[model samples]
Target: MGKWSNQINGRGNWSFTKYIYDNLYNFQWINRENNEIEDNLILTKSISLERVEQYIYFKDIFKGEYFSKLLEIPEALEELKIHMPEGYKTKEDIIDVINSRALNPNLKALDMSLPTHLNFVLISLNLPPHEGEVNDPMEYIVDALEKKYTKEENN
Candidate 1:
């Protein structure tokens, strides 16, 4: 097993946030599916924590219509399945307990910084650096959904 860090969220259930905080670069672009395409672009460069924050902000700006509903455990799991690529599944085992605890004031207070069970789905994938690049594949997921979301919201 890899090293893990467990932090209690508002309801006190442990949020297992696993990541190798390292020099990583990632970028996502548009493409046609099932068509032969060549990508020679690289989005790699050493970025500061501030840049990560900027990326996260830029990331959050393109929110999906169903995003807010995902705070509810079941909705979140379903959203994960839809948003994420196949072979990865969120652990439903904690849904009931998490939903129940969502009513707690403490959890509510800490909700903004908390990771729900759906987060585990990404953690479970354990995607790593590829092609001499160390970017997390999961990050591409956000980019993919954001484009769809933007088109949807604009229409």
Candidate 2:
């Protein structure tokens, strides 16, 4: 098997991690083969904020239902109350808040099956809040990928 297939197989079933890995790996290979100095590969697909919100809401709802035996609906609601942003009472409001804060402006569409757009979505979701500064996790990931792929350029 080729290197990409081997990496994908090794990553197993974590969708987000696998997505990031695939993009970074492929970009690195391209840069190496072409001897090009590129910071990031342009994302072809774009995801709407509405879609992102829907995914988050669905994921949360599914988890609530799937783990109902261990996690009560009331408890889940309480957690949502604490973590969810102010003025975000309904599911739609919460999704709006998440989209406004988490979704990268450069993102175009959702391609969950591939790394193109999903990597940016995952980056936004996975980024931790900074103490005083706004954190754009997608940029951080791009920087990391660039560094990883262009180490020779640095030296």
Candidate 3:
């Protein structure tokens, strides 16, 4: 999760993505000896995003219907990042600052089971704006992780 964040420069920074990753999947490395492992052991199994998308399932479907939505967020952020050279303030700001229609088609993950504040935010970020409610929700999906975990790097 943190190991494969989208931001290359921030490829490994301490952020909130881990909470979402842990909630979605109960995963740990297979260690045969001392049982200690490293973060490099965490990986996506492919180099291509499309190929990765094909494998983003637990059994029969993408982990969350909205997981795909979370996946699309980075591209949207890239657009927003350019428009607001400083930074994007909230999910609605991404729309308002861009002068997009105040309303937007929302995407939600209906069947996935993970429940956590981080999980909620990942989905909320894609939904049509409920302004004056939740604010920036991209901290979870964006590259907010570190190559290596540290007490100081806790998310």
Q: Choose the strongest candidate by lDDT.
A: 2
- Tell me the spans in candidate 1 whose CA falls farther than 4 Å from its real position: 1-94, 97-134
Q: Candidates' TM-scores?
A: 0.22, 0.21, 0.16
**Best of the two (1, 3) by TM-score:** 1
In candidate 1, the residue pairs with backbone N, CA or C atoms under 3 Å apart (3 or more residues apart, or in different chains) clash, namely: 10-107
Better of 2 and 3 by TM-score: 2
Question: Could you give candidate 2's per-residue lDDT for residues 68-110 as a string of tens digits?
Answer: 4433466655666576666766555544554452443223223
Alpha carbon lDDT of each predicted model? 0.38, 0.39, 0.35
Deviation of model 1 at 38, angstroms: 36
Report RMSD for candidate 2.
17.8
Decoy 1 TM-score against native: 0.22
Error of 3 at 152 (Å): 40
- Candidate 1: 10-residue stretch with minimal lDDT: 34-43
What candidate 2 gets wrong by more than 4 Å, as runs, is 1-72, 101-155
